[model samples]
Target: MTKFILTAFNPANGQRARLHYDNATSELTSESGESLVQAVEVVARANAPAVSKQTPLAKSSPRVLKISLGLSCNYACEYCSQRFVPRADETNPGDVQAFVDGLDSWVTSPPEKVEFWGGEPLVYIKTMRPLAEAIRSKFPNAELSVITNGSLLNDEINDWLDRMGFSVGISHDGPGQPVRGPDPLQDPEQRAAIMALYARLAPQRRISFNAMVNRENASRAAIQRFFIELTGDPAVPIGEGSFVDAYDEGGIAHSLRPGELHAYRNLAFHEIRTGQAANVQAVSSKTASFVNSIRSRRPASSLGQKCGMDKTESIAVDLRGNVLTCQNVSAASTAPNGQPHHIGHVSDLAAVKLNTATHWSKRENCPSCPMLQICQGSCMFLEGPLWDRSCDNAFSDAVPIFAAGIEFLTGLVPFHIEGELRDDRKDIFGFSEQVKPSRDRPPRVFPIPVVAA
Candidate 1:
């Protein structure tokens, strides 16, 4: 329940002001002659929806089903989370028919969305094709999606993808393609396939060039420009803009360095505020969610893992019916917490026990973190230096959103944060070194009465 005083510049008047923020309740109040607490409370009461409770794990059904094709890939992305994960025995097309047959008995209703996962899903096209076809036959209307690195796509594959009504995500790190591996764009065959698929799907709002932020490719504006130029569209939808989660030595090397934190935050914040990165979902969606959360007074308890793997209805399975903690980890792998990533087999859903993950409530820092609403809790099972580095990257990555969220709601650009939180995270955008806001002004006589949570 650490409450902190935050300093900012109100853009409207160019006057510096202070605001009190409660980490425990997410309450914000102006220390200027005016107050924001009353307005916040009023908005909270009027807009807050009844909390949407998560379905219990034991009684859950698949609403969003993610089928991991396997860990096999065509390219080696340096920071890919699954790059070094211990892979389970491969499941081939031979298992597809049985897996599809098993679905009818367990999956009572067609899942709203069915995602096919891969290191590069196209690597398993032989298996993927039959499996996808079977699922489509069973649930013709389910929103089928697949993510690929775009190296193996061709006219035949593109035609199959379009006919299947699948929404595709070409996982390309536009400006930083070299670091990810060989550039598929340079290969004429690969280039044509990618462009053809993009042309077909972009028109239907069914494709995105999912990009990740890393030390080498940190600029959202740059990433946006690269995609816009490649797609010949100024409004390309960019997904997965948040910083990467370090899973191995390569991932660790790609993560944000300690010295680069402030610079990255500044650039990210400026790009977001100036609208240069508006097409990126990570920025726009989060800003909207933060504003809405403020209006609704969304409690931190309602938050879940950023990946949604914690939700009972959001299930990830392999062809063998082995349920996993997430798509990133395989059934043969184990979480840092020493629990097997394999929660249970889909054949026995009632016997499933998801003991691999720890809720954010168990983490001492999350409840009081200002970024909890935005980050939720990254990589639920991450621990040791991986967790620390991931948390650090998450904080710097979120600082811009925090500033933008506050600015959008209050017309104030936060420059410095003074609170009971970490010493390093206290200053926002170097405001602590700047001139202090006037505390000499007479305190307003009318105090906004504190609202109980």
Candidate 2:
């Protein structure tokens, strides 16, 4: 039951207040000991579930089954998580049937959501088609989804995806597509195919343009504006608007440096409050969850990894029937923590032991950090400097949402959180003076190329 003292101000009148917060109970109170929030009608999240490398979670039938087709992408995006991970033997069309035939053996019931993964899923379209069709036939009611670079989409593939009830996510870095070595958008045929696929899926509300926030391209508002203008839909949804995890050197290069945190948080907070990043899921969902946490007294212990891969009900696998820690790695690869990516095989579901990843509760600073609820301790499997960089990036990314959620419920903007954290993280924004801004100032914007033709 750790608690922290907070300094907050009303942006409306510049009136200041001191508050108390209990992380375990999600209780916020005024300095006089009056509760500021009433718990909403929901089950209490008293303690976070503890799963670690030593005390691991086991896999059975997954509610969300992620099938990793292989790690063979056409375009190498700069900070791709799967880019440097060791690849297993490439999955092919011939391997699909045996894999599908074996599903019922371990998957006790149909998953609520089934996702096809890839270095690029479209790279093995032949294998993907049969695998997806078989799964769709078996679990017609399950939600089907995929994230693609959109370089290989053609009329037939797009039509097939549409017919299969897929929630398609096209991965693009908005103006920063240059980080992705080849510019498929520059090619007429590839660009046309992407648009065709988007057009085919947009009406059903199953399509999203997924973009990641890197140091060079760090504006959720700009990313939102780019997609909205590109699709000509004011309500176009944006996915993966959060900071990228540092998987390797490329990732660390793009990750937010310590010095840039304050300005980024200030800019992000400004954009979020101004409604510029309203279409972004990272902003909307994080803020809402924080508000709910305070209302529900959500304990730090009930939280899992941000991706939920730590849950027993979520499983990742490849065509050869090797169960993986998550869709991002292969059976042949090893986690940074010295555990094998191949946790177990599907044939022996009961023996599946996931020692590859650590949960948030097991990590340092997570149990004490104010952003614990919003950030969820970054990626579950990362370690060393990569983990540090990812954690830095996540802290900056979540600060704005934390400030916004507090302002929403208490009408007081959080400027500083006096807690067991680094001194720099205590400030919600760059301002150390604690004075309210006289007016909203726009953040600096990098010049972007006009819409891709």
- For each candidate in turn, the TM-score is 0.91, 0.94
What CA RMSD would you report for each candidate?
A: 6.0, 5.0
Name the best candidate (by lDDT). Answer: 2
| Per-residue lDDT value at 197 in model 1 | 94
lDDT of 1 at 349: 86
Clashing pairs for predicted structure model 2, backbone only? 47-301, 47-302, 48-301, 48-302
Q: What is the C-alpha lDDT of each candidate?
A: 0.80, 0.84
Model 2 off-target regions past 4 Å? 44-48, 433-453
TM-score quality measure for candidate 1: 0.91
Q: Which 10 successive residues of model 1 have the least lDDT summed? A: 444-453
**Cα deviation of 272 in candidate 1 (Å)?**
0.3
Per-residue lDDT of candidate 1, residues 157-227 (tens digit): 99999999999988888898788777889999999999999999998999999888889998889999999
Once fitted onto the true fold, the runs of candidate 1 whose alpha carbons sit more than 4 angstroms away are 32-59, 437-453
